[model samples]
Structure formats: structure tokens, C-alpha cells
Target chain A: MAQLLPSVWRHIPERYSLLGSHCENCGKDYFPQRPICPTCRRKGKIVQKLMPREGKIFSHTLVHAAPAGFELEAPYHLAIVELKNGVHLLSQIVDSDSEAIQINSPVKMVFRKISEDGKQGAIAYGYKFKVVRNAAAASKPGKPVGKQSTSSKK
Target chain B: MNRSGIVGYGTSVPRMRIKVGEIAKVWGKDGERVSSGLGIIEKSVPALDEDSATLAVEAARVAVEAGKINPQKIGAVFVGSESKPYAVKPTATVVAQAVGASVHMTAADLEFACKAGTAAIQACMGMVASGMIEYGLAIGSDTAQGKPGDALEYSAGGGAAAYVIGKPAESIAVIEDTYSFTTDTPDFWRRQHEEFPEHGGRFTAEPAYFKHVVSATRGLLEKTGMKIGDFDFVVFHQPNGKFPGRAAKILGVPDEKIKQGLITPILGNTYSASSMVGLASVLDVAKAGERILMTSYGSGAGSDSFWFTVTDKIEEEGRRQPESVFEMLKDKVNVDYATYAKHRRKIKSL
Candidate 1:
């Protein structure tokens, strides 16, 4: 609990807003906002960038074994998502069934509670991905499509 | 008023829902009776990870995207909620940072029971209308609390709504007029450190919800010289499904005019977000040149009323992604009583 405050504060920018660094020279984006671009070293033009929340699953794995502090959410799906800007990051997939998540599945970012420090400690929040099963269906005008079934197609 | 209006608006309801029957089953009460009495079918329940702050951020992000404004230009952020996660910290700062608003922006948290969200809106209108800010974001969100097996549990819900207020030229709907009515009516309250609020039962309606809402609406109409029939739509704060419908009849507004904004029957009462979300739902499908009347009530208690005229810009801005309130309501996942209890943190572990 003592170290929780600093760690939480340090990750605020990246966790909350997906703040990252962009290397103008190579046009590459990096999450966690690196201070210096590896390609150009001191000559690199690095600036703060906000990655688009929309993305697709690059790779994913199901974690049946629970990690400490994540016991209640055990058997959850963890995925490596590649943002529209081509930056990849690891995050937990939520608000959908495991069967609905596939390689290259379209996804969107959502802020959610990641974990709690203790029974009476501070709660940590960060980004998670939810599968957008039918992008086309969601865009259509008129009434909203009720209940997103795993079988629905865009 | 200095020609300020709503540049953009967005709403969010938690995906998880618990039907009236589920709660009824656990308490061994007649589901149909409770459902009929409250006029609510289901209520959104936040996931273990979701709270007022998160809901506010989601709604604010959608509003920002719709407005197509630079986050750096926003001058203020106000979040109104009865369920702010922290007692000491301001939820507005977290919302401002999460939405990438400028660091120099003013931020604060507000509480006025259910009407707190509209109070934030009134504040933003003042700042924007005075030319003191380029744009201001006002948000109302809540994970409303109700005691275990209490009547409040059936209607208390979780959700949020956000609005971006700016110059009239950039607005989707121009603010025609606004009014407020306040008093020391204690129809409902939650004491310090109390887990849930206590209400005066039927007293919550007569002298509190209905009284404030009716007075505010009448005041706005009388001040603006607009009759009930002049408005295209009407929205009232929905503590329960029945109150808004009743208020509409009392104000001489037809049922058809209020139907579009009557979302409480399905989404339950989102406390601070109730009326705001209903207004957003109405705006989603409203056409250019139409007028909207809105009134919000907060137990403790008071009401705020506003009149808006939709512009052509609403057609374009209302179609943006993240979907509308209707879409969010349709796309829901139902959970049983056990899951609801777990999600709501109602089940305690020693």
C-alpha cells in the first residue's frame, strides 16, 4: 500500500488517456511514452501522442489460473491489441464472451477498474477492450440491435 | 443569456442489467406488482470495475468526439454525482485528465441529489455565455445506492450523461431559456457515512419531485412565454418511471411529446443522470427547428428547467460513434440476482 500511490500516479497518463510518444522521423508510435526515440536517439523528434481507442486483436490467451488480486476475474481473456495506429499493447478483454473474441477481432477501449490494492486500499483503473462484433450493424440507422450474440456478423 | 448552447451531448448506461423479476424472486415478492408500481422493467448495474468517474469519462469522450473541438480549448470540467468513488477527491479532475482536457482548466465535483447534473450544466452555461471560456464540459453520473431489499433498489440505477457547452454558432441546439426553483425540502437524504439513502416514501413525490419539477417547468414556460404545445418534446427527472409521465400530464403536455424522453421505464433511475440522459435520447432523433423542454429534480431538493431549439448541426453530430442512448439500452446483458449482488458489491465478505 505504501508504494501504491507513486506507481498509480506514474501510470496515470498512459493508463487514463492512452498517452504515448511518437517518433516523427520514422512515424512510429510507442505506448508508455518513451522519452527518446530508439531509432534516431538524440536526433529523434518525439512528441506526446494519444492513440486511437479503436483497434483489433493481434493475439490473445485465456488465463484460467487467477493472479493475485485478480481472483474474482479469473478465467478472463487477455489479448495483445494492435491499435489503428499500429501500436500494440496488452490488455484484458471484457463485456463479451470468450468465444466472440478471435484473431483480428475489431475492438474498442473502455475505462474500467483494473484492481484494488487491498480490502480498504485505493482502486486502480485502466483501459480494457470490448469486441465490436458487428461494426456495420452498429452503424446502421434506426433502432439499436438488441443483444449482441456471438453468432452475429457485420 | 449570452447565446451559449449545447455543442455536443453523449450518454452511457452500464451494459449489465437486473430485471425487476430477479430482485422480486429473491425477496419473495410479487414481481408484477413491484414492476407495475414502479413502472420499471430493469435497471443497469455497474460492473465491479465501473463507477461514476469511469461512466463520466466514457460519456465525456463521446461528447468531445462529437463536438470535434480541441481538448486544450476546454476551460472547465464539472462532474455531478451522488456516488463519487472518493469522499475527499474531486471526480472532475479525474474526468478532465482522462478526457485529455487542458491542464489549466477549472474542475470541481458537485452534489445536489439527482439534479446535481443539471446544476453543472447551469454553471457551464454561465461560463460559456459570459465568454469566460471557449468550451465547458458538464457531466452527471452515478452508481446510485439502495438498501438491500428496499424499494429504492428496484429503481436505483447506474449511468452518465455529458454535454459540451459553447458559443451558439457552434451548437447543435441553442439554449432559448433556463430557470430554477429551490427550497429546503428534505424529501430524501443520505447522512454522512451512510451506505444508502432514506426517503420520505410517498413524500418523495408530492412536495419534492413533482413540486420542484412542475414549478421549474412552469417558471421556464412563463418566463420564456412558451406554452406546453410550443415545445416538440418534454423531459422530466425520472426517479421512477411513473413520475415523469405524471408530470407531463400535470403540465398539459401530451403523452406523445413525452414518450421519446421516457427512458426511465427501461433504464431505471440513474439519479443525477436521469433527466440529462432522457434529454440526450430526445436529441438523438430530433429534427432541425424543433424545440425541447427539460426539467430535473433533486431530493433535498430543487429543480432546474431549460428550453432548447435544435439546429441542423444536430443531424451530423448526433450520428457519431459509441451509439445513442437507445442503442445502449437495446444492447444489454441481463444478470441474475447473485451476479447483481456481486457486481453491486452488496455481498460482504468477513
Candidate 2:
């Protein structure tokens, strides 16, 4: 429980807000906020950036036997999502049907409970990706879709 | 009345639901009787991992996105809930961090039974109206508790609603007036170590819920000099599907005016989120120039009432989110009583 606190604190900026870093020289973005761009090494000018929340699944797998503390969520889908900025994020896919996930499936970031230490320990929360079925209508160029009106109204 | 109002609003309800029939079957009660008595068909049950904070973050994310403002500009965040995951920590700070609000901000958790959410709204209204902050967020969320075979087990639900309050010029709905009525009425309460709340049953209705709600509504109307007919819609705190309707009738509001917000039949009473979620549902379809009156009652007990006028910006802002309360309601997976127990962690097998 003591060790979990610092780990949760260290990842807050990246986990909560998708804070990443971009290399000024190579025009490439790195998630998890790398302090130095591997490609540029000494010359890299890294600046903090917030990646777009919308992305597409680059790959995925079914986790039938989840690790310790994740037994309740067995058979959940885990995916590597590539945001529009070309940065890949390894995240658990939630609020979705496992059978429906496919390569290139559009996804969106959502805040969800990642895990809990115990019955009384601190519950860790962060970002998870969820499959967005209506990619076409949702990914329209200028307008935001699901964010606007409630279902009955539209 | 100051120039402060709701910039954006959003609601989140868990996908899992347990039917009243399912609950009644386990207790050997008449499912039909239980359903009719509570005016609830089903109630949302949070996943074993989900709680008030997660629900608040989800709702607040949608609200912040819909508002289309820099999250860094939000100066305050308040979360109202009786089921906060941590008894010691502030749920508001977690919500603020999740929503990407700036580090320099004021935040706190509030509790006032079901009306706690509206209390948060009142605080945000005051801050925005006073120009103390550029944007303030008020959220009501809960994973309400109900002991096994208890009457509350039929209606206690899980959900959340978040509102972004700011200057009227940047708002989708403009605040006309707000009022609160309170008294030392302990119609319901949960002690520090108690898992489920205790209620006065029949006593909760007349003196606690109805009295405060009616008083707050009438007080707002009188203070604002607005007639019942002047408002296009009305929303009342829903402990059951019947309470809001009964309160509306007593206040002379037409059934149609309250119908859109009367979602308790399907969502159950989400405790702190009940009336705020109803108001969000109403705002989803309300048109420009439409006036809405909302009054919320919390056990222990008190009420807060607000008058709002929908602005033209609502047409655009309302379309920003892909999901709505109605969609969340329609999209659900039903669980039987045993599964409900497993999800709610009622069956301890240690």
C-alpha cells in the first residue's frame, strides 16, 4: 500500500490529462512524457503536449486471466491505441464488448478505476480507452458529436 | 439575480441495472407491488470498482468538453455525495485533476443527503456571480447504499451529474434566481459506522421532503415574482417515481412540464444526483427562451430551488456530447438478484 502511493502520484499528469512530450527537432510526440527524445538525444528539445483523446485501436488482446487484483474484470479487452498525433498508448478498453474490438476501431479516452489495493486501500484511477462504434459520425471534421445533445433530443 | 448561469451540463449512469422484480424475487415480496410502490422499474448498480468519484469524473469530463473552455481556467470544483470512496479525502480534488482543471483551484466535498448536489451548485453560482472565478464546476454523484431486504434496496441507485457555471454571456442557460429553505428535520440519517441509512419512512414525506421542496419553490417564485405558468418546465427531487409528480401537482405544474425530468422510474433515486440528473435531462431537450424551475430536497432536511432560462447557445452546446441520459438509460445490461448482490459486494465469502 505504501509503495502504490508514489507510483500513482508519479503518473498523475500523464494518466489524468494525457500529458506527453514532443520533440521539436523530429516533430514526433512521445506519451508518458519522456524526458529526452531517443532519436535526437543531446539535441532534442522536448516540450510538454496534451494528446488528443480520440484515437483508433492499433492492436488488442483478450485477457482471460487478469493479474492480481483484476480477477473481477477477467475476459476484458486490452488495446494499444494510436492517437491522432501518432502516439501509441497501452490501455484497457472498457464499456465495450470484447467480441467487437478490432484493429483500427475508433476509441475515446475515459476516466475509470484502474484498480484498488485492498478493501481499505486507496483506489487507483486513470484513463482507459473505450471503443466508439459510430466512428464516421463521431469523427466528423469540424463538429463535436456525442458531446452535444442527449439521445432523445437528437 | 446576477449574470451567472450553467455553461454546460452532463450526466453519467452505470450500465448495469437490476429490475425491481429481480430484487423482489429474492425477498419473497410481490414484484408488482414493490415496483408500483416505488414507481421504479429498475435501478442502476455500479460495478464493484465504480464509485462516486469515478462517476463524477466521467460526468465532469463530458461537461468540460461540452463547454469548450480551457480546463485550466476552471477555478473551483465541488462534489456532493454521501458515498464518497474515501471518508477523509476530498472527491472534488480527484475530479478536478481528472477533468484537467488547473492546479490552483478551490475544491471540497459536500453532503446534504439528496440535495447535496444542488448545494454545490448554489456555491458555484455565488462564486461565478461574484466574479471570484472564471468558471466553477458543481457535481452531484453517488453510489447509494441499501441494506438487504430494506425498502431502500428497491430504489437506491448509482449515477452522477455535473454542471459548469460561469458568466451568463458564456452560458447555455441563464440563472434567473436561486433560493434555499432549511430546518433541523432528521427524517433520515446514516451514522459513521452504519452501512445503510435510516429513514423515518412515512415521516420523510410530508414534513421533510414536501415541506422543504414546496417552501423553496414557492420562495423562489415569490422572490423572483415569477408565476408557475411562466416556467416551461419544472423538476423536483425524486426519491421515488411518485414523489416528484406529487410535488408538481401540489405546486400546480402540469404533468407534461415535469414528465421529461421524471426519470426516477427507470434510473431510481440516485440520492445526491437525483434532481440534478433530472435537470440535466430537461436541459437536453429544452429550447431557447424556455424557462425551467428546479427544486431539490435532501433528507435531514432541506431544499434548494433555482430558476433558469435556456439560451440559444444550448442548441449548439447540447450537441457536443455523443451520449445523453436517455441513451445511457436505454443502453444497459440487466442483472438478476444474485448477480446484483455480487456486483454490489453484498455477499461476503471470506
lDDT of 2 by residue, B1-350 (tens): 57798988888988789999899999999999999988999999998668999899989988888888888999999999999899899999999988888888899999999988999999999998898999999999999999899899999999999999999988889988898999999999999977789899899999989999999999999998888888877899999999888898899987878877888899989999999988888777777888889999999889999999988988773433546567557667788888789878888771
Estimate the TM-score for candidate 2.
Answer: 0.94
Error of 2 at A76 (Å): 2.1
Please identify model 2 stretches exceeding 4 Å from their true place: A133-154, B317-320
Q: lDDT score, residue B125, model 1?
A: 94
For each candidate, what TM-score against the reference? 0.95, 0.94
iRMS, model 1 (angstroms): 12.2
User: Each candidate: what lDDT?
Assistant: 0.87, 0.87
Model 1 segments more than 4 A misplaced = A40-43, A141-154, B317-322
For candidate 1, the lDDT comes to 0.87
RMSD of each: 5.2, 4.1
DockQ, structure candidate 1: 0.24
